[model samples]
Target: MPLFVKDFSWEQTDKVVFITVPLKGVKASNVDIFSSEEYLKVSFPPYLFECFLYDTVEDTDSVAQVGNGTVVFKVLKKEPGKWPQLQSDVIDNKEAMKVKRTEAFAKAEEKLKEQSKLKAEQKRANEQYALKEIMKAEEEERNRIERVKQSERQKATEELEKWKEEQRLAAEKEKERLMEERRKEEAAEREARKEQEKILKRQTRGKKANIFEQNAEGAPKREVGKISVSFTHRQFPTPERESVKPKEEEWLKKQAEARRIVELEDENLSEEEKNPMWLRDKGNEFFKAGNLEAAINAYSHALRLNHTLHSCYSNRAACHLKMRNFFKCIEDCTRALELLVPPVPQNADSRVKCHVRKGTAFCQLEMYVEGLQDYEAALKIDPNNQQIKDDAEKIRHLIQTETVE
Candidate 1:
């Protein structure tokens, strides 16, 4: 053993492990440091201090600094982390090996802990970054949808105006045609009357009627007087047809239409084609075609036939959603949920769909809390459904943003 080290203090930092040996009278140029894979030696003026390394150290990375009556040796660790002890206590070969092994394991564990902490921090940062990116994408999508809807509204307004102008022109043309037809009929009737009068004049050369009158002899006397039936001052309806009216004013006489009345008794039919199922299917078709009013009517008819029909109410709720009838959508969804609470349709997915749709409708109406509640309830029904989770996440974000506002 070397007695050169009077007392030593060892410390470690993020980048380097430092061991300070206090030498009271020793000066520079007299200290020599020797480094090896498993040993470190310091010789200062006829005395030598040496110890076996606890773990691997970079020999070239060693530096010696002298300040304030102390000599400090800072050696960079081969791996960046903590060490349980700076060097193994050189007691004996077997005991020394045991200490070194334990120290090595301790160093390895400390490095592993640091690496684990770093990985955790990185994972959290990555999650935050991904969340930010998702929120940004959602915002962009919403903005794009708003722009598209605005453009569509403007286009629809322009198209409506153009249609109105076209309808006005068509009505005017139709009015003119009716007026000409009326004029032709009146002229024909007048011409026919004139020909009839001419024929009547030829039939009776001088028109007269006879009446019996009393004479002075009180005998029968025949008296005649001329009379003419003239239509000189008669006028036909040559006035113009009424001004062009709106299309709504055009009345068509109701004629019997067979298609308007369905005869269910027709021979060529299946049993399933005449019932609520058929009506429900028909309503679905109407809904898909964008005939919301007809869909509503068909759904109503089906409900009347079978009040407990499984999906009609839900389908009707979808119709209301498309119509922007948010309240009605909520109502229909509630009804469907009531029917589907015990898993009536035996399709949990259908129930989940209803919940999500109703929640979305509530969100559309700006009832955020209700929407959030719905989403949470749906998650309880189907905890692992990814779509429901996503919807719930969206609702939570909306709530958070609204709270910020």
Candidate 2:
């Protein structure tokens, strides 16, 4: 029997490449390999590598060459037991070979379909496995970050606790130090008070002893005297009485003449009976009577009449000072200074008096600088005046002390 290529080959003519027989003396019906023209024309799916040829003759030759001899063959209508089974001879039955070719092609196509399905299933499994691995790696990275953050939080908590403990200890130590300082201060104050009390008691005892000694030294002394007395009586004559009466009449006549002259002067007075110096005299009377308000009014009235009256303003300033109206005193003093004219050489005493009064008003107003200037000017004019000299010294001391401060 001759055998051909079971799978079709596009490059080979009539689906036969190099044919060979496995036996030589076999009948065509008993051969193991055979071929048909219809089988050569069949198309096989790509998965089928070979096909079986069956129900053919057996051969005795070890190998027989194809197309070497003519042999009659009939195709059998039977399915092969297995792929690659042998057939006896080549056949020319186109119908039966066509049916066998169709069955073989259907089997080859079924195997190809099964292989494609298995490959698709394997690809799906591989993708699922890759996805699972990626998810597991992401979870591990997240867990690692959480662990690092937890470690940092623990470190910060420990540090905070340590700082708080240090602060607590520092506060306790400071409190103890302050308490110790307060205790020492209280003890020092108590000792100082005791020393001050002892000094006061010693001073009181010394003052009492001095008073007793002064009284003993200034005591009064007494003296006694004796005297003798005598009495006499006499009668006076009428002629001696007449001589005494005439002397009395002569004294009365001189008094009457004096009275007549004062009457004549009164009758010759002017229409304005009031004196030009009335305001000043009335102000003086009020001052003597201790009526400071009336005295100031009278002095002011005198100034209104004659603005040049420096004495009235100065006297009114004195009254304002006595009433403790220091601002009013300063005003009056200022007015007096504006009205006062420079005095003649012989009237230096009056100028000095005015300056003293103005200085006293300045001191009352607490105008220390002006007050000291006035006192200095008054001392230059009347250095021997004790009151002016004392006032100038006092003002000088006040100015020096204030400047030092």
Candidate 3:
């Protein structure tokens, strides 16, 4: 007997099915259907039918059956070109379809899980990249600050050096200024000393004259025509000694007479007449006695009496030159030169002597160029004087050496 279960739901397959049953007169209690229970076998025709059956047992052996339960299965209509072919095994087809749906759902769920994991990893990677960029930026900023600091340090150092250089220059300038001022002050002091010496010599002239007179008594005396003369002998005797002796005697006698005349003049003088001329005559007496100090004193006194007296200046200058007082000698000679009359006569040997004296003083002072010029002028006047020529040659040599240096 064939039995049909209509509107049957298969829980495993999850599908609705239409079933057909055919009756072959089999005993319903002997059929295996639903649970292990007595069943009613209801058979249908070849058309599809939708119904269900239930069985109720009153006792272990007695059974009551119910049929045509209210469950329905709707069949989809076929299009005109489609053939409606029924599955030979509908339950198997439904089970396969159910398995495919479960597999597809599981595959979709796995794909979703994989996608979520990828997104999480990407987020973490992005965060790490951002952190790296932040670190790089910070490092760059730190380096920039360091560079700025270095630049500032360099600039500050340069400024400090420049200021130091300026300070050094300023100090050097101040020092040079001070040195120049000192030099000028020293020059002024020297000039003042020379003037003071001149004044002192004038005051001491009479004292020097008395000293020379006292000293003259011990000197060697020669007699010439009732005149007694005293003079210092030359250190080296000259080849012209014989010719020089007569001239020397005459010069000595004249000097002694001049001295006597001066002394007598002083004794006879009223205090008013004992003036600059008297001092000059006394100076001449001392000069002839070879008393340079007294001669200088007397000349200085004469100069004090008349500053315009060129002869006094020249005489004093000669005394200073003998004493190796070159600066004072130059000072007096210069004063005498300034006071000299223009158009100096050809016979004015005193002026020429002053020039020669000045040149000697300049040479001693190491004013070589000026000394050379003075010597040259003296040479022009006294061309035959070997002494003047020798002095000029020496000064010229000095000037040449100085120029080469």
RMSDs, each prediction?
Answer: 18.9, 45.6, 42.1
TM-scores of the candidates are 0.34, 0.31, 0.32
**Comparing 1 and 2 on lDDT, the stronger one:** 1
- Tens-digit lDDT track for model 3 on 1-405? 333445333211112223334323444343332211112223333223222112222112322242343222222222212223233232346675455445545655676788899999999999999999999999999999999867755664565477679999999999999999999999988987787778767866666434333335686433222345886556336644445677777787677756754654646556643467777777888877889999988877665555567878888888887776776887888887788767356535776788889988766556678888888877777788898888788888888998999
Model 2 residue 203 lDDT?
Answer: 57
Q: Residue 183 deviation, candidate 1, in Å?
A: 78
Q: Which candidate has the top score in TM-score?
A: 1
Worst 10 residues of 2 by lDDT: 40-49
- CA lDDT of each prediction against the hidden true structure: 0.74, 0.59, 0.61
Note the residue pairs that clash in candidate 3: none
| Model 2 lDDT at residue 235 | 31
TM-score, candidate number 1: 0.34
Candidate 1 residue lDDT tens string, 114-215: 889999999999999999999999999999999987876666557547867999999999999999999999999899778877776685566463345456
TM-score of 2: 0.31
Tell me how far the alpha carbon of residue 320 in candidate 1 is from the true structure, in angstroms, after superposition.
0.9
